[model samples]
Target: MNIALVTGSGGLIGSEAVSFFADKFDLIIGIDNNMRQYFFGPEASTQWNQDRLASDFATYEHHTADIREVSQLEPIFQKYGTDIKLVLHTAAQPSHDWAAREPFTDFGVNAVGTLNMLEMTRLHAPQAVFVFTSTNKVYGDNPNFLPLIETETRWEIDTNHPYYKNGIDEYMSLDHTKHSVFGASKVAADIMVQEYGRYFGMNTGVFRGGCLTGPNHSGAQLHGFLSYLMKCAITGTQYTIFGYKGKQVRDNIHSWDLVNMFWHFYQNPRPGEVYNAGGGRYANCSMLEAMALCEEISGNKMNYQYSETNRSGDHIWYISDLSRFKEHYPTWDWTYDLRSTMTQIHDSMIERLAVTQ
Candidate 1:
């Protein structure tokens, strides 16, 4: 049995990833400093995931150390050494608006933190498979690239796109020239992840993901995406919808779906591969469309208001052209539909609130 390490184990993605890999791997190493507090204030979800893991998972090492601090991270990697088979680097300060305000901490956590992970991988687990969770934001404000049309529910690139090809491909320009502080940071890390594979010949892969959503989320109003939307609907919290007449689109993939794919890549390591991990055009939805679905599930209309101005670096119609990832891992596909996903997020938020209240 191979040992695996996951950074940011308290995050929405990291939380689900830890539970998913707990029994599967011989030993699991979960490191989290709860540094997401820098952006989301005291309302971060780090402790929730940590508590869940403490109950269910055994044969795991839980470290509360910041990845940005190299001294804190290197020891764990060194101890594991060749025993560690895979390293899933998911820890980062991921917030567009927050990144804009505090670009220093954002760069330090994402760009510098990633650099430290690479260094650790090179020093200790030289042959280990490195899987970096990237964002579609690396492509930046891609709404300008397409001829977007707004519908009652959602936005589409065209009336009839081939393969429902309403979204940007990996080949679309990453040279985004507007509101791109967050984009620039992630891009730096994304390229470095690939570079390590190419220049250093490390077994690394990059997943430029779109709207990764699921149940085990902290569900912050500003960032948690679908979970936050569900929280807004269920908790009757005021929610803000920015721009595109609330018809901006995103392909929402469940956390389990993405984590499963990450596992598959770990089992069958490929050299320096970059794949867009998302639900594709068919599963895509707009802000209003998803809110409607949430309302349908929760039996309440969303307490939401739309702002005329768009958020910085927000995509108008961005779904993944997942053909490349599909071709590589033919069996890798998402099972959850938009309706089901919204419902799941609603239920999860409800459950979380029951305990908190």
Candidate 2:
């Protein structure tokens, strides 16, 4: 049987992968313990999504197993054996602030968990394609030091700089900067993913994603940038903008688009190849710009406050340079733009809130 194994199978990217590959793969095995709730709070819990997946897909098998525990993961891998054709590792401690609070938990989940996944894939399903959802945070605070210009609403790179046109690419240095506890953990995992591919000759691909936002995201204040912002806009909750005059720009890529990138990479099976993934120049916004768009979409002015202190290791203006990925996969491109994505988020949030109410 052709099985697709998705870690964090209830979260944004993981759930999207399950849905996208449902018809293609014979069976979909999911591993998730809903650690998100522990990392954030109950509001950030992915239980609702987990239940939804259970009810939606018969092909999907859910396991409340922690990725950090090899004993838990080994049984699943051993049960599936070589039938698992795809291993999409989307689980991680994905917050900069939360990571600082619990360094051990963060490292165990992000770094050790990733290592567990890589080693398991190597031992059990060596031929399966492994796709890791890495983040732009691996570059640390390097992007913040770029020659950026302040505009009326957002921060932008200098017009004359090469990155100004295409945004930051894989060539940017991942050294000599404060990477925060979360970023540092991710960097460890990111490098290992590449090493496994290059050294072991495993079929692995790493995508350093920008703001991975979608309707399915369990948006929290510390993470889920666009999702959480739109949630605040819809619920009339006060949203806080931390530092950089709220002009820190991030390119937003829909979860489906990112999963689609994974699909392409799986088909081609590039070993140790890394690509920058995001909305790129096509779909991006500043914090202020995002708030304005959220207001426009929800038809409610966002309740927001400003803070002088910015999150450590945060970028000022970082739009992904998708030129490399585009050049690699000529057929792949973004399907959702910023406005369309935000509108979907607004609509979806309304639907979900109504259901809960």
Candidate 3:
């Protein structure tokens, strides 16, 4: 039986993976403990998404297991063994701000949790295609050092820079900058994932994502940039923009689009290959630009405040260069652009809010 195992199975990306691969894989095994709630409070809890998955897909077997606990993960891997064909490790302490509050917890989840998964995969389903959802933070503040031009509403790379047309690529250095507590832990996990694949000759692909967003995301103040911003717009909650004069930019990729990249990679396995994945130029926006789009879509003038201080290790401007991933999987391309994606988030939030109300 072809089984797919998804860690953080209730998250924006993990749940998307389950839904996307439900028809393709025989059984979908999920491990998520709703750690997001702990990381960003009750509003960020993914339990609702978990419940939705259970209701939607019978083939999806849910486990409220913490990836940080090796004992909790071992039995699941052992039970399925080689039958598990795809291991999607998406669980992590996602916010750098929160990471500073507890460095041990952050390292335990992001770095140690990844090590556990890799070791388990190595011992059990050595042949399974392991896909890790790494972060752009791995590049640290290195991207900030680039020659960036500030526009009226957004920050853009210099037109003459090689990264202007496409965006930042994997070749960007991952060193000598403030990575924050969260980025440091992710870098540890990121490099380890690569090492496992290269050293073990296991098929592992690392995708460094920008802002991964969707309706399913349990948007919070600390993370889930677009989702939270949209939520605030719909609910009349005041949103805060930090530093770079709210011109900080990020590429936002829909969850389905990213999971599709995982599907393409799983179809044709590559060992230790890393790809920068995001909306690219096709679906990117600055903070101010995104706020405007949210207001446009929700028809609500968002209550927002700007802060002079920026989040530590935050990118002033970043858009993933899809050239490498596209070159590798020419068959795959982005289906959701920025406007459409935000519209989906707006509509979905409205439906969900109505239900709750």
Question: Which runs in model 1 stand beyond 4 Å of their true positions?
Answer: 160-163
The Cα local distance difference test for each model comes to: 0.83, 0.94, 0.94
Ranking by lDDT: 3, 2, 1
- Residue pairs in clash, model 1: none
Indicate the worst ten consecutive residues by lDDT in candidate 2: 322-331
Clash number for every model?
0, 0, 0
Candidate 3, residues 212-245, lDDT tens digits: the string is 9987999999999999999999999999998999
The deviation in Å at residue 241 for candidate 3 is 0.7
**Model 3: ten consecutive residues of lowest lDDT:** 39-48
Model 1 Cα lDDT, one tens digit per residue, 71-148: 898788877798988899998877788888888888988899999998899889989999999998887775456776
- Residue-level lDDT of model 2, residues 5-122, one tens digit each, is 9999989999999999999999999998999999889999999999999999999999999998999999999989899899999999999999999999999999999999999999
Give stretches of model 2 more than 4 Å off. Answer: none
